[model samples]
Structure formats: structure tokens, C-alpha cells
Target: MPATADFKFTASIDDSLSGSSCWSAPSNIALVKYWGKKENQIPANPSISFTLNQCKTITGIDFQPKKNTGQFSFDFLFEGQPKESFHPKIESFFQRIFPYCPYLSHFHFSIDSQNTFPHSSGIASSASGMAALSVNLMDLERQSNPSMSEEYFWQKASFLARLGSGSACRSLKGQVVVWGEHATIQGSTDLYGVEFPDEIHSNFNHYQDTILLVDKGEKQVSSTVGHDLMHNHPYATRRFEQAHDNLKAMQNVLTTGDLEQFIQLTESEALTLHAMMMTSMPYFILMKPNTLEIINKIWSFRRETKIPLCFTLDAGANVHVLYPENDKAAVLQFIQSELVGYCQKEQYICDEIGNGALKIQR
Candidate 1:
């Protein structure tokens, strides 16, 4: 039996909920490169993302649909927009995806979304967006599979969410998440997001990351395009190895509390990781002037003030400063007054390493 709603979208529901349950998933920054996925968007190997402290998305779902094919009908309220976009991509997803995932097709969604940070600041909003969507979508799943565990639901959701955005799979959980090694380069890879163990969570508490709004310009070589470059890259294997090694080393440092080692490995890995993209035949340069400037400043900080600020980049110009949380105060001031300089005031997103991703209300 399906329940239909005319107020939002009319569709079928086995049972009607009192209302809607809310969930929020925090945004994350890749301390290491999670680039280059295989077909179906699986990654070459496992990589991780840190659920950020600052950025996140909240979504609420009251699942009653306007139609009865048991299809995926969604009405989205994107952040701050006067009206819901009902973005074309989403509509198309319902039209196409419902056939395979029949349950989705029947229900229509009344989705409300808001971003804690700027939409396109290279902060990986898609990660949180899809995460929130999937988690919130679970309400529909739960209606039927009341016995299904939350973990199981999230695993399944991550798998589906990846088809929407690559980085999104990681946003299904908090603290730390990995798309695993099964993914292709563009994040198009199909891999379930896994939460880290409590020990790993405890170990990462002191880690620091600062998002630098470099040049604050457009993102070149969007993650998807970057993956395409990776597919055709001659040194793809080497780059993959580099990313894997970096991830392993990062995990070790977090586990062992090795700050110095973490800094050294992180900077080298970021350069080499992006270099693989730079040298690609089709050249994808996502780094803005401030990206390089911040890099140089970090280096100079090491030489002049003797700071231990290491840097990492994802698919965009925004640079993340990875350092020790204890040193965070000085880290923020140093970047604001010294490294960032007054010149680049136009582009500055000073924030520390944030917590892992989680649903908003849930």
C-alpha cells in the first residue's frame, strides 16, 4: 500500500509518520588525495575525509508522494533560495533510478536544505548534501525495514549516494570515513562509506585543519574531470601508490600521535598528488594563486617563525592547513596576520580542523 500527499508530493507510504525526522551530515576536507576512480566511479584505492567542524547540511523529510508508481519524486528546498529548485538532475534521477530501486519511485519528497557555509567554497558541500539526503531518505527505508540496523542503512545509502556525488559517500558518518580502495578515480566509484573505530576517533582529536579560501575563484578540473585525467594518466599507478601511501601514513600518524611525521608526509603527498594531475595530458590546475601563496607561506613560516603548519588540497583552490590542535590559536592568527597577508583578504576561510560528519537533527 502506498500513501499519497497532495500538499507536497503525493505518493505511496506503507504507513504515515507523525511528521518528519531530521538529520544533519557535516562537511569534510580530504587531508589526503582521494583522486582517480575507475569506471562506475570507484576509487583506485581507499582514501579518507575528515568531517569538518564548520560546514554541514541539514535535511528534513516528510515522505508522502503525489504519485503512486512507487517512484522517486523529490521536491528540494536548497539553502536560502526563495523557492525549491527541483533541480533538473534530481527530477531526472527519479525518472531513471526508480525503475531499478522501485521503492524510491513511489514516494515523493519534501526536502528542506540549508548550508552552514558558502555553497561553492570548495568545501565539499556535495559530500554533506548527498549524505544528508541519504540519511534523511532512510526514513522511507525504515518504514519498511524497521529491523534494519542504522549502520546497514548507512552503508546502503552511501552506495546509492555515491552515484550522485563521489565525495558524498564519505559524509554518511562522522569523525572519519573512507570510500575504500574499491572506488574509481572520479569518486564515481561504488564503495560504501565506513566509520573509523573509536580508537581512531580518539587519536584524531588533536589534528588540525584550516580551510584557506585561495583566490576564492572558480574550481578548475572539477573532481570528475580530474578523475578523467587520472584515467588517462601514464603515471596513474604511481599516483595511486602515492595516495595510498599517504593515506596509510596519515592513519599511522593519527594512530601513533606523530605530528612531525604527519606534517612531512602530508605536504609531500599534496604536491605529488596534485602534480600527477598537473602533468596529465589534459592539464587540470585547481590551485589558485593563494593556493601556492599559502604553500609558500607555510614554507616560510617553517623557516622564519618555525611553525609546523602542513598543507593539503582536495579538488579545488581552497587549501586546508593541517596542524596540531593545541597550536590552533597561533595557527589561525599566524595565517590571518602573516601568511595570508592583508593582500588576500578577499579570500579567507579561516577555520580549524572540524569534527566528523553527522546528520543534522538525528
Candidate 2:
């Protein structure tokens, strides 16, 4: 495990430094689910996820030297328009990561970001958005310390992204990533996410994830609030323990190509995540009537067709339908005929497993 001090930037920056970088990072769907957290953005339990392809955020940063104001100086834009509402979150992120990237105060930055998926479409943009911003900041840091190793670059990027948003760390690399400490996963830590070290069977390659947008409206309870509720949650301890065991089981399922076990574990994890939400001190339900309708349709389709398809939710009413690449044709057909009606305005996104974030060359 890497200590916090290891990430502190000790290198000198040239006063005349000015540059720009753009990065595109994908949103990931957690398989084991990270529902709770500890201090300093540490996960209460380890979780693994599939990096997505189409659902991503692209962020570009242009920075130039400025008088030292002892404060972060930046303007933020969303999809080419000023979004003052987003400023607080970005400001908080900059403050949290300033310790690791101390030169932030030395430059005035113009940051613009856009998501591929529709805004407020029930997809959480934090994972990809923060990952893109972190990598872009690292790109600037590389100019100050050109000798930085490739491994260190990604590790620090993941680390900084975690400070912004815990799940953002996992968006840095790999088709599958593991975040938080677990006995079964070597090199895993709460400080940052690590790529799955073991070889993944070809059976899991090019896996499909079709996101059905059930509610596009703002979440009644934000993920931060939901995570905080777990502080006094009745089943918090057992849920954490179950996450560890499920992660271990998922490792075997991925390696041995056990689709049956995969479906069971994946679906179970999703329901258990919502179960925690429903059973919390201040009980809440993120799932809508349509959310349950879509889920039932999937169950019936799978039972009749004998397809290895399953669903997962991410703290919202939206459902991510997962299936093998080979079963896409039939599964999508079922979605069109049955599940699409349940979505808000019949909105959905077709995405697949992706390698990871990319640096866009200008």
C-alpha cells in the first residue's frame, strides 16, 4: 500500500509553464458494489467493476502561469456553457487534491467537460468526469517532472481521482478494476484502484451493458447521503463482509466462465445494494414502479429464453442490463419489445466493456 506522502509533489515547476490536455474516461458499473465509505474517501468494503465504453466524460484543461493567490483559480464549463451550479463540487475536488498536486494554485485554468450520455439521464458522471480531470492535471504535472514512470503516472492519477470521488479511481484503467483492500486481491488498497491482476477468461470479453434510463430527474437522495446513512445501518457489518466474499466468488466466476454464478452474484449484489438503502435509518427507495417492471420483464425473458442476462442498479432507478456479447441480438430484441416502454421516454444507451481511459491527441 502506498502512503499519502508518496504522492506529494516535491518537484519544482517552471514559472512560465503553460499547456493544455484532454482526456476521455469511461464510467464503470460496480459488480460487487461499494455502498459505504470511511474517512478520507476510503471504501468500507472492496468492490470490482466493469469499465464501460460509450458512457464517458471528456474533459479538457488549459492552464497558464499566474500570480500565486494561495487559492485554486479556474472556470468550469459543462457542454460549452457556464454551469455555476457545478462549481462547488469542482472546487471541493480541487481543494481535496491540492495536497498531492500543490502547483494547482500557481496557474489559472479553464476547464470544460462534457458527457457522452445525456445530462441528468440517471447515469452518474462523477466516475468518468473526475477520472478525466485527474488525468488532465497529471498531464500538466508530467511537464514539471518528465521522468515520471508510466506505472506511477496511472497510480497517482487513480489516487487523485479517488480524492475527488471514490469510484473515480476505478475509471483509470483496465476492462475490470478492483478498488479498496481485500485479502484475495494482491496489491489492492483503499488509497487507489488497481487493475485486476489475474487473467480474465475470453468468455467475459466484450461483455454488454445496456443502460435503461428509468428516471431522468435528480436523485431524491444523493450517493454521498446514501453512503453516509450506512454509518448506523443495521446490516452494515454483514454487508461489508458479504462484499468481500462476493468479490472472491466473482474472481472465480470470471476465470471459470460460470455465467450462472455470475448472474446470481451480479443480481444479488444489485438488490442488496438497494436493500441497504431501503433498510437505512431514514428509509428510501430509488427504484420506481417502472424499475421493478423492467426487472420482472428481464426475469421472465431469461426464464423463457434461457439466456444469461442480468441487471444491476447504481443508486438510482436506472437499470444496467448485462449480458454476454454473443447474446446481444436476442437480449436487445427482448429489451426493445418489453423493457423499452418502462424507461423514461424510452431512453437507453448501448455500451460494452472497454479497455480504459484515453488521452486525446490534439
Candidate 3:
């Protein structure tokens, strides 16, 4: 309810408690991008996103009591192999959240995580990965505090996930999610995301997002670096204002099934994301030539076919081709015949609207 952690209660550590948790969380594509941020991982402007089905991360943690120490410890793995490189990030995340979950200090953790799509290929692995991890952490908490209500459980997970990655909070739900503080949306706050209240129109619900992996390689600039650049960006204020206004319009579009306005706002947000990057002080461009080609082709295809299909980009060169489910036959055909050539190794992930994170019983 508050914008930050209320810390209303804490779990008393039980030495006999030794359990594990696993969660599968779907990646999300932002229709309204949250670019800049403030301290505590709060977004500068509210954004909306669509949770995707195919691109996901499954993370499980095995925990047991540590002997004679209250220090945080974890062995992180990626795809079943030990990954020392991922340790620092996870360690950092643990440190940020350790205060709220002091029980973490009493256990050693073995984390196993894997992704269905390429990890850093602009598919939002952080959103899925961090959300999965956050849910698992809360699941662990529920073991000691079984009386916790379901609403508080998810709110805590979304809160913790945001501390790890700002957008990760949005990955906690399905169809559509909104993160960051907003003036119009009720219950919307900067601490965690809230799902859209209005019933999403069928046309927008179950929409398709065919990821065109123009470049599978990592970006020259990480999203962290990109966000920091906004601190001194000349257009930061204007961009933030635009995002707020766009989010308002987007709400109406989703509720009323205004596909034309949807396409316009989505594509504009995508291009604006890159435009910010290109205009940064130490300017850098993330969109490759093939990214441009795909964009142009998508525009031409839409013009020629009059389909409601449109494209959006993350911080990388990859393109997410979004359209209504009814248009999938034509859209997929267009991708197979025209857009596949631009992808690295013709690699693309077919994804659609999805329900948020799932807890694995095992």
C-alpha cells in the first residue's frame, strides 16, 4: 500500500526449516517503456507491458541452515553449470533484499536457473529471472509464516523483484501490467506493479509477440548504463512527460480495443527508447542495420496488408512483432517469408500473452 517497504512483520527463523522453492516466470515486452529511474529502483515514469509465454526463466533454490554464522551465501548456476560470473549480481540482489528478509542470513542457497530464450538477446531475462527468484524467496517465507495472506505474498514478491530490476516487478502478472507511480491509475505505485483493472479487450488480450532476433549478441551498453545516462540527458524531462501522457492514452486504447492507437504508441515508445540512447552524452547506437531493415519491412508489410501488426524494440537490436491473435496466420507467414532473413541464424522466439509467474511444486 505504501510506496516503500512497510516491514510490518518478520519471520522468526526456525533451525528445523530446510526447504526449496522453484518458479517459472514469463518474460515481458514493454508497450510503454520505463527508461529512467530514481533511487531504490523506482521508475521515473509509469509503463505498461505484456507478459510473454515462450520466453521465460525457471529458477529454483535449495536452502539449508548455515552453522554458526548469519552471513549471506549462495551458489548460483546457469543451465546446470556453475556460473561464477552471475554470483556478483545475485549477491548484490541478496544484499539489497537481505534487510527485509533477515532469515536469508541463516541459510546457504543453491540457485539453479535456466532460460528458454537467449539470456541477453533483448528478451527481458531479468524480468523473468528476478521475478522467479522473488517468488521463490516469498515461497520460502511462507514456509515459516503459513498464515500469510495471498495478496501480501504477491505484493512482497513484486516489491522484492523491483529492487533487483525495475521492470521485473511488471513480470509478476499476466496480459497487461503497469509499474511506477501514476496519477490516474488507482493503487498504482512506484514500489511495485499493479495489473490493469479494466477488462482488457479481446483483441489486445492474447496478442502475439514474435521476437525477431536481429542480433543475438549482447549490447555494447547495458541497461544499467543506459538508465544512468538519463540523469544528464537533455530530453529526460520531455521524455518522461511523453511517457506519462502515453500511458494515459494506452489505458484507453487497451480498454476500448483501439488497435490503431495501440500500434502508434507502441512503435513510438520503441523508437523513443533508441532515440534516447543515440542522443546520450557519450552517444552509442544499439540498433543494427538489420534492425532497421526489419522495421522498414514491417511498416511496408503493414501498409500493403492493412494488418494491425506493429513492432517494438527493447534496448537491443531485436524486434518484437506484436499483433492480435486473429492475425497470427498472416503475421507468422510474413515473419517466415520476410523477417526471418534478418535474424541471426534465423533465430526467433514465438511468444504470446501469458499468465505471470508459476510456482513449481517440486
Specify the highest-lDDT model's number: 2
**What is the per-residue lDDT of model 3 for residues 251-272, given as tens digits with 9 covering 90 to 100?**
9999899999999999999999
Across residues 231-340, which tens digit of lDDT does each residue of candidate 1 receive?
Answer: 77899887777776777677677677676787787677678777877899888777777578778878887778666777887767677887667677888888778666
- lDDT at residue 117 of model 3 (Cα atoms): 83
Candidate 3 — what's its lDDT? 0.88
Report, for all candidates in order, the number of backbone clashes: 43, 0, 0
State each model's C-alpha RMSD to the native. 5.9, 0.8, 1.2
lDDT of each: 0.65, 0.94, 0.88
Candidate 1 lDDT for residue 166: 73
- Whose TM-score is greatest here? 2
Which sections of candidate 1 miss by over 4 Å?
A: 1-18, 80-86, 92-100, 182-190, 201-203, 342-347, 350-362
Better of 1 and 2 by TM-score: 2
Clash tally for model 1: 43
**lDDT of model 1 at position 337:** 82
TM-score of each: 0.84, 0.99, 0.97
